[model samples]
Target chain A: MTNQKLYHAHIEACVEAMNACNLSYVANLKEYNLEKLCECIRITRECAEICSFTAQSLSQGSQFAGEIAELCAKVCEACIAECAKHNNQHSRECIEACRHCVEMCKDLMVAA
Target chain B: MTNQKLYHAHIEACVEAMNACNLSYVANLKEYNLEKLCECIRITRECAEICSFTAQSLSQGSQFAGEIAELCAKVCEACIAECAKHNNQHSRECIEACRHCVEMCKDLMVAA
Candidate 1:
């Protein structure tokens, strides 16, 4: 079984990213007519889903938790890149959350 | 932009998989102490998350919807394999949902 204590920070970051991405997704979805924000909405949804799954896997001590963390980090980076292109508060918060998640995933990978 | 009409069945299957996986996850979580069911619980959560994102992207006509569908199909397959090992109502439903999702994803991919 995996140890949750060791990856607590990583899990927290992933959860934070998930929440931020979900908020951003909903905000962007409302403005669906905006062509420029389509990619942002899509990537935010992707990031949220992956972060949610990664957080759940870590919390449950799944055998592939580390691999999921790696994938989550990659998606966070993509979310950050896309969200950065927009200047809204929601995008800013999402970028911050994704950045933190990436850092935490890096630490978790190193610790593993 | 991706056309939702072309992939309506795919989106429907993804939603079905998502709902079934969520149900299975909740059902198995109550029995989290059962080591044998842990994998099922974890995979169900994974499948649910990916299916959710894939459905949202397809509904929104995201440019990368096809790619997401591909990933969703792969996760559904994993869920099917893991859930198959367990013989329970939740697992059975998950397996059926994932199987349908995989078939729809395949059709969507070919059409794309």
Candidate 2:
């Protein structure tokens, strides 16, 4: 894929991850056993924020896009690891989105 | 001031900066002299995103809050520099907000 195509794909993946992580974070907060899911909630929220920022920076073609992508990938990986410990639907979705985001971020980095 | 107070203050400053940057970015996009304000628009958008993410991360007490704050300060500085070149009301507000954010970020880092 062209660099432009890779950029677009990466942005899409970041958005997807952002949405999923947000949803999972909210869901985790609403859980009765909040203590057990504290890390999950925190990581998911952090991942969502990073993913959203990365997508916005990429859309603007900002000079910091590469740095933002690197952070996004790292956050996504952390989110995936945390969410993978859970079996809920939201966590599953978050993990899947985060995994996709990590892959896209790597591809975008390579293309850069 | 306590660390918690500083964190809350930093988050507030980041939110203010984000709002100002977003407003300035949108206003710049509507300007007739689009070519001259292109850098202003781009930097404002990037600054807004970073400020937003930094605020969210700080609010969540995320482990990466420090890193996000660093990036937020950097982006806010860039926005301030770019907006200072423009003599519009929106740019003025953006510069003020970004300057405040940078100060708050510095304080938070020192407290850390």
Who wins the lDDT comparison?
Answer: 1
Whole-model Cα lDDT of every candidate shown, in order: 0.82, 0.76
Tens digits of per-residue lDDT for model 2 on B3-85?
23236677667767876787687677768989999998889988887877776566555666666777888889888889989
Instruction: Quote the positional error of residue B101 for candidate 1 in Å.
Output: 11
What interface root-mean-square deviation (Å) does model 1 yield?
17.9
For each candidate in turn, the TM-score is 0.52, 0.53
lDDT of 2 at A48: 79
**Lowest lDDT 10-mer window, candidate 2 chain A?**
A1-10
lDDT of 2 by residue, A16-104 (tens): 78767866876777689988999998888788778877765665455566667788899898888888889989899889999999998
Q: How far out, in Å, is residue B46 in model 2?
A: 8.8
Top-TM-score structure, candidate number? 2
The segments of candidate 2 whose C-alpha lies over 4 angstroms from its true place after superposition are: A1-6, B1-112
For model 1, state the Cα shift of residue A32 in Å.
6.4
Q: Tell me which residue pairs clash in candidate 1.
A: none
Query: TM-score, B chain, candidate 1?
Result: 0.92
User: Where in model 1 is the C-alpha error above 4 Å?
Assistant: B1-112
